[model samples]
Target: MKAWQITTPESGLRLAELPDPELRGGGATLDVLAVQIPAYTADLVAGGRGGFPLPIVLGAAGIGRVTATADDVFGVRQGDIAVATGLFRSGRAAEPEEALLGWTGIGGDGRPTPTTDRMRDVWRDGLCAERALQPERTLLALPGAETYKATEQLAFLPWLGIAGAGIERAEVRAGQTVAIVGATGQLGSAAVLVALARGAAAVVAIGRNRDALDALAGLDPRVIPVALTGDRGVDGPAILAAAGPVDAVIDTLGAAPTPEPTMSAYQAIRTDGRWVLVGGVRQDLPIPYGDFMHRRLTLRGSWMCSDSTILDLWSMVRTGVLDLSLLDIQIVGLDDPAAALTAASHRHGLEIVVLMP
Candidate 1:
């Protein structure tokens, strides 16, 4: 099997032929159909900040078909289609340095377990590989849903959880407005879809990409575009006024740490409304308490969500509410994972996927 390995933090990837992963005594093996790269997550792990086993196969999400399984497993079956994310609970024997690979889950005690921390490992073995040794519990059975485009589903799965989970935290209501900053980015784009599906009366999409925002106008006329750049100023009240009242703000970009538009969203969100941020913006920085307090606003953070949340997102995909076809998803091969990472790092394009060769 040809696997893409990130041997060092600074060095690029190398596609090398390695022995195929062996099945655990109790788990199942899957022949991967597609592997989606959560490029941003991969970059974070490769940078060594994500606290995962290094040089591991780097992927966080993808879809595949089960090829073989242990007799005791009943959650998933041979030839059944599934989407795997987070981490594998039990599988391949761990190497000295690879013990941290399958730990991406949040444990019962509320601590981030192996499954939560090692997202890159989860992506690589669970989602990106042509053949995967997946614990039955780690794979979600996906029934045939014509609404789900396989390629698009692979690209959007991880981010859908990120965004959909944020919406769930916000508890948005119908006849209410939601603002999505960096609305054209992968996570932000997914948030837009989820917000509409949840019945947000209006979606105020804010971003620097005119083309991307313009493209969204045709897909769903409810998205109101607000173009914001650092050099030029944005009037928060006016933008929200134009969108008519803002009830919730979904910020995928952090203005204090990375960009300035996030600050605008803070000011625009109605008092007592919610602002759910998933992007790495403004984590440690001091927020304006006066503004936050005046509105009695709820500031919340969202993680990848529990397994049940991912299943709920899959349910949305199974139904017609969340549209994957409009997203910018491109599937690539294993030999060239860097290009996808580059695009995601620079925010130059949409979802970049590296599928099994």
Candidate 2:
């Protein structure tokens, strides 16, 4: 089988003919159809994300058809279309932190311990290949995916799952106005759709791109687009003006160098409203402790979605509430993943890149 392998930090990715993965106990082998190239794939390849080991296949989310499965893998069978839902390791009484599939190959909280090192053998390789072997816990079967040509929809599962988890954490309710920071990006756009599908009275799409904001607003009349001014004082007021006193805010700003944009979103939140952080903003936010205390604001951080969240999202997609047809998907081949990675980095608006392996 051919796979894209990252041999070293800051080194170029190379296509290598690797041996087929062996399906072990409780694991299944998938004939990968399509895998989403996240914006951060380049960062991971360049060793900016974390201490991911070398010689690893670099993808976290994909949709595939099961070609084979172990006798113990009972959830799915051969010929089933399944999506990778991140890696999950069974918890022990002593240590119970679950590690994800892509970067965190070793499944634990942080730092590679002996337990994680041993578990690395199970999850080291990701989905960027002709075939992938994944544990049963990480694969979710999509029953009529082939009939609907849902491979494009699979590209969105990771982002949608993250956004859904954040929205769920914010406890957004029906008839309440919700604001999605960085709404022009893929994650933010997904959040807007999810919020609307969940019956939010209105969605405020806040971002730095005017054209993208306009495009999002055109999706639904209830979507109110607001462009960020970059000035903290002005942006906060702009967001509030467009959304009209939002009840909850889901911040999806990724790797924001400064805290101003996020702080502005925080300021725009209504009193007692929840602010959920799911993005990759790196700076430390200097929140006014007293103001936060008096306003009764709820601040929460959500990392990823659970099985239930994925099930709910799938149901919404199946029912037509979450319309994925509006998304612009770009499919590429595994031979030139570098070009796809570059394209993913420069991607804006509703455009998303997927690798057809």
Which one is best on TM-score? 2
lDDT of 2 by residue, 2-32 (tens): 8998777656677889999999898899998
Q: Model 1, range 1-357, lDDT digits (tens) per residue?
A: 876666666765566666777766456777677665554544454562344455565554667777877888888777777776644443443621112233232323334445445533443454455566766666776766323555445546666777888888888887788888777776787788888888888888877778777765556778787877653244476566757658888888633344456767766777788988776573453478886788898988775655677777777777766767655656567666666566455542244554655
> Each model's C-alpha lDDT?
0.64, 0.82
Per-candidate TM equals 0.81, 0.94
Clashes of each: 13, 1
| Model 2: CA > 4 A from native | 104-112
